[model samples]
Target chain A: AQSVTQLDSHVSVSEGTPVLLRCNYSSSYSPSLFWYVQHPNKGLQLLLKYTSAATLVKGINGFEAEFKKSETSFHLTKPSAHMSDAAEYFCVVSPIAGKSTFGDGTTLTVKP
Target chain B: EPEVTQTPSHQVTQMGQEVILRCVPISNHLYFYWYRQILGQKVEFLVSFYNNEISEKSEIFDDQFSVERPDGSNFTLKIRSTKLEDSAMYFCASRDGLAGEVGELFFGEGSRLTVL
Candidate 1:
């Protein structure tokens, strides 16, 4: 089965600084990857997704990620952090065009 | 921009009591799904439904768990006997049957279940 692993349980970044949340996956086939953000007391919102089409996919709120087949990773990155970006981020993977398999999740804290 | 919707943001029930969580997916969506997160645990897929039948299910979805799309808009998950361990956030999600295509599953705010 396809699965995802988030390297960090939590991450803290200062405003205007770069942010990185690491994620890795194990799949037999080229998988579909996604990043979702959820604030406290709110529903989850999709950040970005990487299908087979693009290696580097851009997402909302200035977040982006690169699907590296050789590295087996799809790490979420941001050039500048904002206070509103503070939320629980989950890395999910799906079998080739299949249902999503979510990771344990990484909580992001942005300090202004 | 139609989205999935879930009912009863929070429900409190006693152990052994049956609880049904309701969901209304996007109007044109064809596939429905149910997932659960046991407070701080990973999100686990419970079951996937399509064409008014179950297409897939996980081991966690045992005999006690059941799903049904009673009418046109309502998708429901029913637990025969609730347990304390069942107290967690149950999320309802849906996809527009674009499997071979490029659409992702949209999730609802989730129904928080608390078994007392």
Candidate 2:
């Protein structure tokens, strides 16, 4: 079985400040983890993915996430938050053959 | 760049009415999936289709729900009878790769179904 947990339902940050959204997962096999962002009324866009290649993965729009094996965590981070960064982010875990499990999502609210 | 496309961006229907959501996945993609997200809720997997048949489905995909790749370039999800609880944003996604190969999924904007 595979499951994902986004620790924060909502995270508020001021523009130009650091941003962090925590996520954890449990999978039987080596999992493929992904971070997706959805703007209001928009489709889910792939931000980045970790397939046991690099522990630190960089994504578009200045976003990045580090996969911590010991912690079983893949937390998204941005050096500086921008107003356009406000959106809903989802953490997903996909096994080798089955369906992917999605987290409840974290709403990032960037205040200008 | 190629992307998934869905029709009926938003549909409103009365309870018990049938609804068919359509999608055109990226050409050359082999795996397809349907997912839904209720208002302010997490996205949930409904079903996955590969090679013209259902490869896997979640419990939420009951007898009332059916998926079909009736012809080339079109994938459809039919609800024999929709309920108020069925109102949600349905997203269609596709991936191009063999099993065990890690690939990112391409998603459509989603069809918002409102069951009254």
Candidate 3:
């Protein structure tokens, strides 16, 4: 079985400042990791995905996450936070060929 | 871009009443799934369907739940009986990929079910 843990239940950042959301995973085999964003009352939107390639992956809307195997972490980051960035972020992990698992999710609040 | 779509954005039902939530995945997608999220809880997988059969399912998917691809376009999830705990947001997703390979699964906005 695979699982993901989002370190924080909620994270707040000042607009125009940096943003970081932490996530860790436990998987038996190589895993595929993803970051998705869901705004209030909206569906989830894919942000970035790590499919066993470059450890540092870039995603839409100026967001990125690094897949660190030794640390078993996939932390999402951005240099600047926009009010639009405020939303619920989910860290997902999947096995080589199995069902996907989602974290409890981290709600990001960008304060201007 | 083609995306998944669901019907009845919100439905209210009495306990013990049957309700069917519907979805239409991407036209060429081969795999389909149903997931639910209780109020302020993590999303939980219910079932995955492929090749006209179920590929996998979670323990939460039991005798009360059934999935069907009634036609070439529509995928529906029927709950035999609703309970108060059944009030939640149900999401439908679809992916087209083979084992060991990966593909994106598009998701719908979600259908909120409120069982009284």
Candidate 4:
């Protein structure tokens, strides 16, 4: 079984401030983790993924996440948050050939 | 920059009515999936298809839900009878099935179904 937990349901940040969205996972086997962002009324877009390569993975829009095996965490971070960064983010876990399990999602609210 | 495409951006239907959501996945991708997200809720996996058949499905995908790849380019989800709780945004996604390639899925804008 594979599952993901997004620690925060909502995270508010001021424009230009740092952003962090936490996620943790439980998988019986080695897992592939992903972070996806969904803008209002838009499709879910892949932000980044970790497949046991680098511990730190960089994604589009200046977003990055570090895969911490010991902590069982993959927390997304951005040095500076932009107004456009306001969106709902999901953490997902999938085995090599199984369905992906999604987290409840974290709604990032960027205040200008 | 290949992407997935879905049809019927928004559909309004009465209870017990049937709904069909269509999608065109990225060419050359061999794995397909259908997911849904209720308002303000997390996305839930419904089913995954490969090699012209279903590979896996979730509990939410009851007998009322079905998927098919009719005509080779179009993947579709059919609901025999939609209930009010079935109202949600349905998303289509595809992934390359090449060996040793653990690729991310490409998604479509999604079809919103409103059951009344």
Number of the predicted model whose DockQ against the real structure is largest: 2
The lowest-lDDT stretch of 10 consecutive residues in candidate 2 chain B is B96-105
Worst 10 residues of 3 chain A by lDDT: A93-102
Q: Across residues B7-42, which tens digit of lDDT does each residue of candidate 3 receive?
A: 889999999999999999999888888989897888
Give lDDT: candidate 1, residue B67: 98
Candidate 4 lDDT over B1-116, as tens digits, reads 89999999999999999999999999999999999999998899999999999999999999999999998899999999999999999999999886865679889999999999
TM-score (0 to 1) for chain B of model 4 = 0.98
TM-score of chain B of each: 0.96, 0.97, 0.96, 0.98
Question: lDDT tens string, model 1, A17-78?
Answer: 99999999999877888899888877778999998988999999999999999999999999
- Candidate 2 local lDDT, residue A25: 97
A7-85, model 4: which lDDT tens digit per residue?
Answer: 9999999999999999999999888899999999999999999988998999999999999989999999999999999
Span of 10 residues, lowest total lDDT, candidate 1 chain B: B95-104
Q: Which should have the higher DockQ, number 3 or number 4? A: 4
Where does model 4 exceed 4 Å of error? none
lDDT of 1: 0.89
| Native interface contact recovery, all models | 0.47, 0.76, 0.38, 0.73
For every model shown, what is its TM-score relative to the native structure? 0.95, 0.98, 0.96, 0.98
* Residue-level lDDT tens digits of model 3 in A17-97: 999999999988888899989888888788999987799999999999999999999999999999999999999986644
Chain A TM-score by candidate, in order: 0.95, 0.98, 0.98, 0.99
Cα TM-score of candidate 3: 0.96
Let me know the TM-score candidate 1 reaches against the reference structure: 0.95
On residues B5-99, what C-alpha lDDT tens digit does candidate 2 reach at each position? 99999999999999999999999998899999999999999999988889999999999999999887999999999999999999999988765
Q: DockQ of each candidate's interface versus the true one?
A: 0.59, 0.80, 0.61, 0.80
